[model samples]
Target: MNSEKQKLSVLIITLNEEQHIKSLLDDIDFADEIIVVDSCSTDKTVSIVESFKNVKLIRHRFVDYTSQRNFALDQAKNSWILFIDADERLTPELKSEIVTAINSENVASAYFIYRIFMFKNSRLKFSGWQTDKIFRLFDKSKCRYNEERTVHEKLIVNGPIASLKHKIIHFSYSSYEDYKSKMYHYGILKANEKLAKGIKPSFLLQLLHPLYTLLYQFIIRFGFLDGRKGVIICYLNAYSVYIRYKELRTITSSKI
Candidate 1:
């Protein structure tokens, strides 16, 4: 279809995402164009992408998630852009809904899609991971990823958003080792963001944060319903809090 008649573009930012890129790309083949903004990955990621036809690839250094997303947004030629993570894939239902939504004139500027987080090739229904909504598909001009932080990049937009029904599968972590590595890296970024904002937690507060996280995720969120997997996720979530605080303390100590 022509740009004016029926045009939808897929934007994915990647860095060493060789394992997950092919699966994600396979699901969104219905899009008119696919733009991959890579951060100089030193893996087979770029080579695999080169095998795909009509996929536009751009390379740039990694600064943060927001700027990388903005780069991809600028490269998207089509008016409609669906931003997705390299580890994420659009389901059949979501593709159908997106195509339908694009054809409609009265559809909202952006929409939130449910995310299904998976671990060890199994979908985690509980553990506060399922039924999570994230604003991903939006008009390129109306929205942008906030450049304020790193780990949790917020989609800062001026208008209201709509919701979609289908789920986007997220194979975020393959193993516990990978999860721990991510915790350390993301915790560092989060601590830096907090410090930049002049926010600091007291000693007791920081210590209690992890415990509260465990309680909320395991009990309040009913994570235990998911069985052993739920317990593991809750523990990991709590550990993330501890790692963030430790990183924060390290930053302060280094400055002193």
Candidate 2:
């Protein structure tokens, strides 16, 4: 098939994302089709998406990230797909690269995209965030999200892969409180998932495990070079780790 004729389908899953939906929709409008698999949001998110051109909105019951994402994948009509989160933006460089790649005669089955995380309107260059990469753009026939993972779910690609130099922007958190709330929520989800696997968070593991992540991110990964921002990230990471095990311990103790 000719590269220019190969259309790209962009997909996203949303709940109540009024604050970030419209901007994101506008950013990804360059794609041939915009597929939004919303989780029945009781807000202006759906209406905002409907206002966009070349967009198709489908509502589904929320379960887990992987399940919702996999469901979104099935909704795409094109062979090429690009997945973007509500808090992410498809930058101009990435947009051009994506179109160019799909137009290539010999394109990889999947592409790994790095993220430029935003916090307080600042781009995080370190704090272990520089390592944030995901297989987001790919041929739908050769890729699918693994539904088993509750958090940190990954896409399973069945063919050759490549990387893009440009990065998509991610608005990681709006405020410190928001970050903590996310930590609390994701931590519990992770804990429950671990419990389901028959893995227990021991007394020491609960305490020490989190510190290891802090050290690794701040020291080993040079998160400290990011300055005060790095400190906050490292601390939040440790807090999230602790919260996950704390939730795990609570859940397990109740069962006992």
Candidate 3:
């Protein structure tokens, strides 16, 4: 298939993402079309997108990450879709890779890209974090986000997957406060998911899991190489687990 005829589209789901959308838009403007599915942003998110003629905006209520993403996919008018988060930007190399993939004859229906996670001014490359890949680019017709009741949603694909060369830049945490707050929010969602499915963890399991998580991410994942930032991420992940299990116990005990 010819590259120009493929009609590549970029789909993004936003909610008060004004601070991050500018960079995302700048990087992905190379797409044939841009679709923004917003859950009613109270900030200037809509206005900023309004400045771009290539961007099409759709408003919908918040359900979950998967639902919002799938809704965006349903509205896209392209055969090829690149799903990007508001905080994520496609690096120049990644954009070039996507173009090459779209123009190729035997490319996979879905492709994974490495992610470079940044926090504050530091990019943590180690402490057990390396070669982290996400299935972001997909053929819209044969792929969609699974409507899973989880915070980190993944795409469901029907064809072979490929890997991209450049990394997707993820501004995961701008501040320490933001990181802690997000962990709390994600912990709530995880605990609720566990509680809904009748999955129970023993007290010992809860106590040991957080430590194991910290060690795994820091030692095994090599997050330690990220310096102070790596240590912070490892600690936050461990704390997130502790909070999640604590929430789970509370919810379960209430039901009993």
Distance from true location, Cα of 236 in model 3, Å: 0.9
Q: lDDT of each prediction vs. the true structure?
A: 0.82, 0.87, 0.84
Candidate 2, lDDT over the whole model: 0.87
Best by lDDT: 2
Residue 92 deviation, candidate 2, in Å?
A: 1.5
Model 3 TM-score relative to the real fold? 0.92
Q: Could you tell me how far off, in angstroms, the CA of residue 220 lies in candidate 1 after the best superposition?
A: 0.6
**Clash number for candidate 3:** 10
Q: Tell me, by TM-score, which candidate is best.
A: 2
Comparing 1 and 2 by TM-score, which wins? 2
- Tens digits of per-residue lDDT for model 1 on 1-256? 3335658889988889999888777777898999888999999999888888878888988877777888788888887889888888777888999988767667777888889898878888877776588888887778877878676778877676888888888888688888777776777777888888877746775789989999998988889998888888888888888888888888888888
In angstroms, the error of model 3 at 163 is 0.1
Residue 239 in candidate 3 has what lDDT? 87
Error of 1 at 165 (Å): 1.3
Ranking by lDDT: 2, 3, 1
Question: Cα deviation of 104 in candidate 1 (Å)?
Answer: 1.2
Extract clashing residue pairs from model 1: none
Candidate 2 per-residue lDDT, tens place, 198-225, comes to 9987989988989999999999988999
Error of 2 at 188 (Å): 1.6
